[model samples]
Target: MNIHVEYNTEQNRCWVRMDDWRVAFNTAAEAEQFVERLNARLNAPHSWGMLSDWSPRPGAKARANLRCAKEA
Candidate 1:
């Protein structure tokens, strides 16, 4: 991912930019810290697992599967 920490002279603030999204910070140090943390998180190994075959219990209502439940 393309990311950069930059200072905006017009706004007198620093920001971390990732593509079209920009997160502003009051100081350059804050922006740099944010970038460092973001990089760390991105580089860390992910333990997320894929979903297995799953279903609601027998005799259960639609609400038992929250995804199948309609908004009230």
Candidate 2:
């Protein structure tokens, strides 16, 4: 897998790209920390998986609504 990092001046954010996956962070340090965690998971002996609960948690809907509003 190849990773690339770039800063977007217009957005004033840092972005990290891994193939089709790209995520933006508020700062370069945050982006770097994300990369480091990802690297650690990839290099670990055991396989790591991502699990999400479909059941709602406290404030989950509110957070989702906020994100949707921000996107709009």
Candidate 3:
């Protein structure tokens, strides 16, 4: 997957745009640091996960299953 990260310091925010998904974060950080710095820098939500499955195939039913927790 491709992720485009853009930062707007004036607004104290960062945006993560992906081909099939999008999410907004306060600042870009390594996985470990995201938790440590999540509260201070976050004006809005620090991060959000976009649903990649927007629609189902003709023969498939739409469903979402969180397989497991990821590091970040």
Candidate 4:
């Protein structure tokens, strides 16, 4: 569940790296929150890999809906 956060100013993008390449949020604040939550998961020991992407507001919303397919 752990997550890592990184910002790409050149690309004007923010990313959240976790067990899944899920763009948790489009806004930096939102992404940071998601990253914090993901970090909490790191408290538990386990093998983990990064899942990251650069997404804008629209894309983030789409991903959100896709994540919860029923919602879409």
lDDT of 1 at 14: 93
Model 3, span 5-60: residue lDDT tens: 66778888776655676556755773224434433343344333433533345333
CA deviation > 4 Å runs, candidate 4: 38-72
Alpha carbon lDDT at 22, candidate 4:
55
Q: Better model by lDDT, 1 or 3?
A: 1
Model 1 per-residue lDDT tens digits across residues 1-72: 889988999999998889888888898888888888888877887655512433335445644646521131
- Residue 64, model 3, lDDT: 41
lDDT of 2 by residue, 19-70 (tens): 8878888999888888887788777775234234322463765565544312
Q: Write the per-residue lDDT of candidate 4 for residues 16-61, one digit (tens) a residue.
A: 8765775745569978766665566656565434323433455655
Compared with the true structure, model 1 gives a TM-score of 0.63
lDDT scores of the candidates, listed in order: 0.74, 0.74, 0.50, 0.61
For residue 66, what is the lDDT in candidate 1?
Answer: 62
Show the lowest summed lDDT stretch of 10 residues, model 2.
47-56
Which candidate do you rate higher for TM-score, 3 or 4? Answer: 4
Most TM-score-accurate candidate: 1
Tell how far residue 67 is off in model 2, in angstroms: 16
